[model samples]
Target chain A: MIKKFTSALNLKSGHVDLSHGGGGRAMTQLIDELFIKHFDNDLLRQHNDQALFSVPAGRLAISTDGHVISPLFFPGGDIGSLAVHGTLNDVAMSGARPLYLAAGFILEEGLPLADLERIVISMAAASKAAGTPIVTGDTKVVERGKGDGVFITTTGVGIVPEGVNISGNRASPGCAILISGSIGDHGVAIMAGRENLQFETSIVSDSAALHGLVADLVAVAPAAIRCLRDPTRGGLATTLNELAKQSGVGMAIAEDRIPVKAQVKAACEILGLDPLYVANEGKLVCVCEASAAETLLAVMQQHPLGRDAAIIGEVIDDPHGFVQMATTFGGRRIVDWPVGEQLPRIC
Target chain B: MIKKFTSALNLKSGHVDLSHGGGGRAMTQLIDELFIKHFDNDLLRQHNDQALFSVPAGRLAISTDGHVISPLFFPGGDIGSLAVHGTLNDVAMSGARPLYLAAGFILEEGLPLADLERIVISMAAASKAAGTPIVTGDTKVVERGKGDGVFITTTGVGIVPEGVNISGNRASPGCAILISGSIGDHGVAIMAGRENLQFETSIVSDSAALHGLVADLVAVAPAAIRCLRDPTRGGLATTLNELAKQSGVGMAIAEDRIPVKAQVKAACEILGLDPLYVANEGKLVCVCEASAAETLLAVMQQHPLGRDAAIIGEVIDDPHGFVQMATTFGGRRIVDWPVGEQLPRIC
Candidate 1:
């Protein structure tokens, strides 16, 4: 990622200009000083246009995600960390162990050098924490008005172990649905940060890497687990509906069995939003055979990222794949697919 | 890339709305009717978050590129085709056969649906022409003011055949340098489009996928091909400087032996841009043993992309790693590392 710099950079108060991304000495210097000094991997150090490696013949999973979230920094995480976690989780959903990452950055001209460095450092830390190295990357700068501060896109490669065959369409008529921890944390945090909400809100995004917890679940019941998916973007209800439709079935659940933090519930109610539709970054939905649900719950509860794991619903036989929920008042309502204007750039 | 659409999209007379990227029914509908319809493949039709595939045990190369070029549409291509070519070229530089690609798109609200569809169709055509498939992808939207039209990022995965080992650092002091074709087509085309230069300029970008050409060269003489690199953003002079520095050697060339098209030369002369410093998307620089130069030149000239191949320079031993050019005049001048402001977002 870097080359040996001939001089030091003015990172303290420097701003990115057109020359920094012009593929000249200035761009090389920035990479040498900022990117190379931090990423510091053997593959990146080669300074080649591509990173080369050898892998054994096996089933490999590849996922890509683009993060264009507003308010680059938030209560619990920044765009840099979120970019890494988002792609990693996507690859992990296949019950695969992420091996490498490739990132591409689009920076707007005049962005503060300090802020860019902070994001890079945060991204490196997140990758390192998850034991995945960014082997290759590309950077481009746009005109001042053509872009926001910065947009990051990450692609992850993972190798699924033998005997693991997780996919969204594997959910059948009798499988049970389980979640790893609470919901609405990430959505509520982004809303509070964006709106300021006229008070000191205790909301923080639950944007943690869930591959480790997924590894645990896959290790315990490789075949019994039907599918795994992170409840992101449109949140738990939307994800459930997707799974049911993909598997050609329906779902029924008890509202009391689902888990939600008190603060998240309060914030959603105040904002006129339903908790079931809000996003959760660090949580996941797991579908498995009903016989193995208890064993899987025990395994999930033993992990740090999955203490609040619960069996929220069970698959049912319905041609329309409707997700019906039994409310606390003993009333039944269908959980329809989410519709309407999206919270733009919410990661 | 797509899901089943409940209804046809508002394609002919509509613009992209925020809901199209909101991870709801609207987003799915857009993807189903547009992206999926164009980029349909067996792996993509599976509808998994990640694409799973198996490969033979071998060395693999990966490259990532973000295309944020201005004037999204130009003479030879748009941002979509450029995105595919850019990354495929990067992987081809390693003497690898590109097999799969993953794409991420960031769309700005209010973008015309017709323009987006045009770009998507062009990208799908490019991918098909190159024999590589878009296996998995993602989409995110930013508010109108936060982005320009659209930016695309692509990552490529390729496998290197046995006995072909290429690296930037493989050039020795006694190696020879060669170029595939003429320079400055892409840079001149972009300049003419952006500045609306006076007179009818015949310049068109030479953006192309070079894996087929590269495979021919590697197949003929795998061991003699020491290093291969495409002169994209930095052009021929800057690319030579990078190779010299990486190989810890110097380079000397005769100006009369270099190849340049008549139209590109006239355009560069009028625009006050040096053809040697202008970018060329479809060109490449090869460094190999002095003994194999003629054979390699013959091999390159036999291919369509390398018909104008020429032996431009020879590597030399020097502590400073300078690239000296014997000019048309009687003097020798050093081609120093390019410094100063750059032409941003050219490719």
Candidate 2:
């Protein structure tokens, strides 16, 4: 079957055209040579519109996210890796073991075949490394000017272990707030890659899958961890505010305790942006019982992705749900959620 | 909590801006008043990055589709209904009853809030009518000119019944081929909606959810049904060719027996397009045992979505796997898979 369609695709020099998304012979050839060849699995090999499989009886977690960063190729990561890491982190935040993924691609006509292939290869590598397979997918094409290079929407599903109850509304007073690593790396990296930006830095996107670290944390303290969130689009400040509002509590943190790379701080200062509100692809905020803070901090520190982990703040009993920061000058100020995004298309 | 953010949104006069997708206060406000208000469910109300729920032990089917149809509105349907029906139909093609959906939206900046709300309402109505609730979702905003009006990607999960097997590769020689209703209406409607088309017709899109009809068919003849497919995208000819190749058999159908609306045919002729290669939204092609064809046909005809159901073809023993159609003028021609899509972005 593949032999009959291999001649239709010119992977070396061809560009995506209207026929590639026409749901005809060209589309089949593309799916066969590029997608199926890379994402080969028994379920996907069935050539059915949907993949069928059995699941164990347990709680399931589902998440979906769209990736449309301006620069397809960023400093530390590209849109492909970000798409997978973003959705997988969302599922893992629920203390679920990530299992399967479904991807949808919106490609602009006339995109280089080489670039598309590179993105798919990167996605396949990321999914394989994370132990999640993309089982089913769909592709659509628009006119040249109607779309950017490409946009990917990934949806993931995972199973939560019994007795594990993690949610955004589970935080309460006396809970300890901890961050996995330094913030502002991803947002600053994206900004540096933009054409108008004239800054140089070694800071790279913190776009790594956190399911492994999450699995380790859930193994040690399933009940102690109250909630988990990854600071993505609106960064740390927005995430904390959301948690505070959702849990109906307040947060107090010492500014000196939060970890921020010097380069990121310099970039933020120059750009007039707040590091607290910049995005981080691979960092997470964990709220756990105050008693388990030390143990979880040690556990996180042992992991490569969490070497810079820190216990930055604590939850408080306040009806107003204000997040306050104790400045280095020994004064307190409100860390309000920004009205709008300072950086657009930061992913 | 809602009172504090009520003043930020002016739905009647405002347009989507970068702030709405920035994951900031504006994003939260939009979500609270629009998405959460309409897609209100227990899982979504949790306000977590992911939705967690328990599922029964069984075989699960998952599918994803991207809808980027040009001209947000058409004759009978819009992008919202197409987004829901397309993915739901993909799941139903496996003889599964769809349970839940996850939606991801990429909104271009400057799009009217009213348009977004209307699309969301239509989507919610379709989901409710089909009994498939959207449990999780994410929104991203792109710069103006970087995207069309909006693109929606919907992912669905359904449960396949035990002891039932349906796949594209399950067709065998002597199997009966059945279609649910008329074809080409969707593609013609979209083409008519595009600019510079001077034709006038009352042909409305056949965009609908067909899971209810599929459920009735499965209940009556689960084991007898060999394969199922929805003739979307490249339409009936492409779908038939794909099934023939997958099942390693040949197909023989009479062109006169396959139902095509008079208006749709007239439009196709005027545009130099073949009705067999045009798209359909609310249709399905089923392959079943020759002995059980009558019973399944009766069951499908009783359903509202399948009043024009007909068995217009049969599988044959041919290694070449060719699909041959007998013309109304007493001639046989090879119904080859189209080399490219005749109508792009028709959904």
The best candidate in terms of DockQ: 2
Candidate 1, position B7, lDDT: 62
What digit string (tens of lDDT, one per residue) describes model 1 on residues A1-347? Answer: 12346767888899888777777788778777787677779898788889998899998899999998878988899999999999999999999999899989899989999999999899999999999888999888888988999999999998898899998888888899999988889988888888545445788999999899989989999999998999888888888888887788898987888899999888888888888888888999999999999999999999999999999989998888888999999999998878732366789
Cα TM-score per model: 0.97, 0.98
What is the C-alpha local distance difference test score of candidate 2? 0.91
Largest TM-score belongs to which candidate? 2
Report the Cα lDDT for residue B88, model 2.
99
lDDT of 2 at A266: 97
lDDT by residue (tens digit), candidate 2, A122-203: 8888999999998999989898988998999999999999878999898899999999999999999999999998688989
Q: Candidate 2, clashing residue pairs?
A: none
Best by lDDT: 2
Evaluate every candidate with DockQ and list the scores: 0.65, 0.81
Worst 10 residues of 1 chain A by lDDT: A1-10
